[model samples]
Target chain A: MSLLEVKDLKVRVDEREILHGLSLSVNPGEVHAIMGPNGSGKSTLSHVIAGKPGYEVTGGQILFRGEDLLEMDPNERAAKGVFLAFQYPVEIPGVTTWNFLHAALNAQRKARGEDEISSPAFLKKVREVAKSLNIPQDMLKRGVNVGFSGGEKKRNEILQMALFEPAVCILDEMDSGLDIDALRIAADGVNALRSPDRAMVVITHYQRLLNYIVPDVVHVMSKGRVVKSGGKELALELEESGYAQFEDAA
Target chain B: MNVVVAKTGTGRALGDAFAVARDRLPGKGAISDLRRQAFEAYERMGLPHRRIEDWKYTDLRALMREVLPLAPQPDATALDRAAGTAKAQAIEGVRRLVLVDGVFAPDLSDLAGLQKGLTIRPLRDVLEAGDALSGQAFTADSSNPMIALNAALATDGVVIEVANGTVLTQPLQIVHIASAAAPGAIVTRSLLRLGRDAVATLVESYLAADGATAYQAHDALVVAIGDDARLDHVRLVEDATGAFNISSATVSLGAHAHFNTFGMTTGAHVSRYQLTVAFAGEGSKVETNGVNLINGKQHADTTLLLDHAVPHCDSREIFRAVVDDRAHSVFQGRIIVRPHAQKTDAKMMTRALLLSDEAEADNKPELEIFADDVTCGHGATTGALDENLLFYMRARGLPEKEAQALLIQAFVGEAIETIASDTLREVAIAAARRWLEARA
Candidate 1:
């Protein structure tokens, strides 16, 4: 059985339909890359699956381990192991990164009836993860994402991803604002978390990031639905030929 | 056509109450004349209504349903109750000066190991001596009637004088505790004087003893910062929901003086803080920050008149309010730069967060700059919590209420973080967190 399944998902935002009959399946230990042009509803799909408000799933069945995912709240979905690396992480002024991370981790643990992580232990885990991501310890002391460079913001998202250790990861435009070195570092962090029991959905517009974190399958998305699914080489083809033919073909 | 101005019932009650208790009031001689003059000022002004620009948002005439008679001085039982409060609210490493029912209680205060160059006296003594400084704050610097009312009815308060060139590491805390059980009003006037080149930290708190319900408070603080002196003042006020308080603060800064202050209020049914600050000498800087966490039909208003009367003076004011559950918050910030006050720098910003649809926030920020070379700017923003931020937090597994508390904390933390003292900042943050927890 697939670890995650989306069957004929249709989503509307503000009375306007964005995703129509989008379907996909992901097994354990797999990485699926969804390539699309701007306004292809990639982010909408990620947000809808994460249970963010304002996205009305008009017609869809999202199953996580055969459980109905749409019925849960965003926090419940998060506690059940779903994480989204935001394209643009919102800056929460006056809230230090360490405090936000600790709260988030403990809240999830509490929701699952597990004991909270002690402050010292949480600090140790954060330091280990932050060190691996080259995130400065001072950044943890500063307000979350406040005054952070674009690269720093993306890396901070990766740090959260590492800390949360979600079973399914959705990387949305992770390479948009990162420099090559920063992108490599972020991709390395993602690679380290790609365990046999974990799955990932990489949503990006360009084929640039697929080079660093190779995808097992690449799906071409146009309008709101996936147009083609093939092996990883499909990304190189699209990169060489550009998305114009796909837009016209659809 | 003939027009007559009628006084409100509350106004009439206050006047009749004053007439009945005038002989029982503190001070005599010249102080007696000052009290009569101040009360006359209050009588002439009547009750502040919406027509008055200063009271536009607060409509004191309508909100003040009735005026309670002055509370009696604390008896033995009252002192025993107040000692526990003073002990509970005590900050470690700080000396406390206690006032029970607006009367100074030395037994509850920490005056055993008095530091050198620091002198503390009850304001009754200064009022009895007819000290010129005691009457300064009640004058025309503020047209608000409450200042005059405080002057006329005040029973007692603390007066702290720091000698010139004296530096004290330990902070001095003045705890104004309303201890009378029956519903009544409390009046106090505290004064802090910093001599030339002196440095100190002052913390004043307004508290109510257990069972003290439906009381009214009229308190004032007059501050004088001398040349090259530095003062960091923190004012924290928390009372029962049935309480009503009107507090005023007037500050004058001398040449190159530095005055940094932070105020937080999370209590009372109707509370107003009228602050008047003036830079009397050049090259002085003042930083004023405040937060108001109001809920459940509470109303909090902060009116600031910051005068940049001298050249090369810099002032910054940041105020925030979080209104929930039909509560209302008001902020009136006015910065004035005189014609010759060139090179003056001033900035004021106020933000309000409305947590419920029924809540209201009024932000009126004005700048009157006559000096051409001065740089001045003011901004006011009233908004609800950012839905995107909430979604972001919830997506990361923080529950709804926790996410909201965190955001509100962050919002108020911007203003709280300006406190220079670690201890005071922690106190402000902890109070804010408790306010959040109660909100949930």
Candidate 2:
């Protein structure tokens, strides 16, 4: 079975439909890039898949490993290996990043019927990952994303994605606020997580991120639906000729 | 041409109770005159009602219509039960002084590792011996009816003195345990004096024995910090099962003295903690912070007054309360910068979080600055937990309840961080976690 199968997915927010009959299938070991304009429903699709509240799934079926995904809560979906890297990471004051990550990891482990990771082991792993991601060691001691620069917030999101090691990862406009250097570091972190049994969906408007994390399949999303699906060259083609044609097609 | 008025039922009952028990009250000597004067003042004012501005949010006359009679002295059996309760709440590496039913239980207290220059005595003994300090401790001429009542009916407490230039390494814990099975009232008054250049840490806790219920307590602590001295005071009150607690702390700081106070109230049917800090000397500093966790129709109030009576003194107040399940939380903070108290810097901030639909929070922060060169400000915020923050945590694999608890913990952590001691901060955080767990 495919890693994820979204068949005729329909979503509404605030009495208005956002994702209109959007359907896509992601297979294991494949990378799919969903490129679209700002309001083309790329974020809505990722949030819906991640089970965020405030989005009503009007009419659709989301199958993760052939099980209905909508039946689970956000945390359950996370334990089931679905991760969404937030576009605008929240700043939770007084909650240190170290404590937040430790709690999240233990909660996921508990949900999977596993014992908690020892403190030393968890600390060592966090140090290794944070160092590789170039996240300041002092950042772990500070409040989560509080007083962080825009680039730092994006990197923090990537660091979380690396720690969770989800089976299906969705990057929701993760490259929007990052600079060139931060973009490379974030892409490197994403590249390090690629595995044969894991699938990733990188959603963005600009094609600059696609240059680093190459996708096997690229789809142009317009008006809440996939208007075109092609190979890696499609991203470059769209970068050259903006999304105007795709918007016209919708 | 004045009209005669009828006394309130609570006021009349309290007057009758005082008249019946005044003869057998514990204090004598100079304290007797003070007590008589305090009772007269209380009689004139009566129980504070909604009409009183300071007690607007907390109307004791409406909530506590009548006061319970004084609790009888605890017997040996009751003291033994109190020992068990003290053991449960005792923190490691601290000297514990147990008080059962408003009387000090020295047998239950551990006074072995007594550092030199430290003296501890029972308030009853000091009052009977006619100590001059007792008069000063019992004399607080405030309009607070509750404090006046405490001065009038205080049965027993502790008198602690730290000699000049003495710095104690360990903290002193005063544990007040209510073991009374019957519904009654307990009044205790404590006095703490730190000599010049002396430093100390004091932890005062109030807890009810297991299965105990429906008891009222009026407790007061008068603290005097001498020149160049420092004191860290922590007050923890957790009395479950229909307990009503009214506590007051009157602190005076001398020249260059430092005082930091943190109060945590997790359990009580109706609890009001009043704190008054007076700067008696120049260049003194004080930081007062507290957290209140209330649920299940509970009512908790934290009223604070920072009196900058001297020049070049600083004060900061941070208070947070979380109200859930129809509970009501109140925070009233007033910072008064008196005239001629130049260069006084004072700031107060109060924040409250309401969990349930019926949960309510009332926050009033006021600043009265009479000096032209002082910087004084006050702010109050009342709202529910941010949904975005909660969803962010839940999306990161935390369950909904855990996410909410984490946010609430972070919210209250601002006030808890004011505690200077690492061990005490951990104890406070642990208590907060337990409150959150019970709430969940």
Estimate, for each residue in A1-250, the C-alpha lDDT of model 1 and write its tens digit: 8888999999999999899889999998999999999988999999988888888888979999899999999999899999999999999988899999999999999999999999999999999999999999999999999999998999899899989989899999999988999889889989999999999999999899999999999999888898899999999999999888877766
Winning candidate number (lDDT): 2
Q: Show model 1 residue runs off by greater than 4 Å.
A: A240-250, B1-5, B129-142
- Residue-wise C-alpha lDDT for candidate 1, range B1-440, written one tens digit per residue: 54454676667878899988787677777678878888877877876779998899998778976667899878999999999888887788888999888889989988877778998988887777777766654443435688888888888889899999989879999998888889888888888899999999999888888998788888999999999999998988897788888989999999999999998989888999988999999999999999999999999998899998889999999999999999999999999999899999999999999999999999999999999998899889999999999999999999999999999999998899899999889999999989999877
- The complex in candidate 1 yields a DockQ of 0.82
Q: What CAPRI grade goes to candidate 2?
A: high
True lDDT of residue A89, candidate 2: 91
| Candidate 2 residue-wise lDDT, A1-250, digit = tens | 9999999999999999999999999999999999999899999999999888899999989999999999999999998999998889999998999999999999999999999998999999999999998998999999999999988898898898889889999988878888999889889989998999999999998999999999999999999999999999999999999999999999
- lDDT by residue for model 2 over B61-154, one digit each (tens)? 8887777888888999899899899988889988998889888898999877689999998898888888887787786855778999899999
Weakest ten-residue segment in model 1 chain B by summed lDDT: B134-143
Ten contiguous residues with the weakest lDDT in model 2 chain B:
B1-10
